[model samples]
Target: MGRILAIDYGTKRTGIAVTDELQIIASGLATVPTAELMDFLKDYTQKEKVERIVVGEPKRHSNEASESEKYIQVFLKALEKQLPDIPVERVDERFTSKMAFQTMIDSGLKKKQRRNKALIDEISATIILQSYLSRG
Candidate 1:
């Protein structure tokens, strides 16, 4: 089976995570600049047999789409155009960031490391992917 990729799309940075061929576990892959996300995915798809793409959908407490939804929509459009054959899905990411922060605190990470947004992004992506996996 091919791997499944998950993206935590943001305006500044995009976090990436991937599942194993068996789709059992999700691991943080990378955090890249949003501007380079498409190219990065293109390269990743060439190197890895990615069968599906899942993007984190931002929403407010009221279940309304957040402002970031606009950007994510654009990103989805681009992704669909680029990878026409692959399916791109969106999973709710309401508290992934907060959960990731709590995880860092629970893990006893240093303040400096916890402050690293890139690290948080990666962890959030991992959480998002894991949530998706759990649903299935």
Candidate 2:
């Protein structure tokens, strides 16, 4: 089976992750500028056989879509248009950032390293992908 990819889309930056060919483990890929995401994905997919994509879906406490949904919708549409064959799925992303932070702390990262937003983003994407893998 081809590998699965995950995206944590943000306004300024997007975090990326991918699963092993067996889909057993999720690994952090990179954090890229939002504007560069499409090109990055296109190139990455050209080199790696990606079968599906999982995107983090942020929701409010009331179970409604978050304000970021609009941007995410646009991103998803673009992805669909560019990669029509690959299926895209949305997974709940509640507390992913918090979990990332806790992971950094547990790993004994320095305070400065823990505050690195880009690292956190990548870690968050990993968590999101891992959660999906666990479910499957």
In candidate 2, position 104 carries an lDDT of 99
After superposing candidate 2 on the true structure, give the runs of residues whose Cα lies further than 4 Å from its correct spot.
none
Scored by lDDT, model 2 comes in at 0.95
Each candidate: what lDDT? 0.94, 0.95
List model 2 lDDT by residue over 1-136, tens digit each. 9999999999999999999999998999999999999999999999999999999999988989999999999999999999999999999998899999999999999999998998999999999999999897
Candidate 1 structure quality by residue, lDDT tens digits, 1-136: 8999999998999999999999998999999999999999999999989989999999999999999999898888889999998898889999999999999999999999999999899999999999999999
Model 1: runs farther than 4 Å from truth?
Answer: none
Q: Would you estimate the TM-scores of all the predictions?
A: 0.98, 0.98
TM-score of 2: 0.98
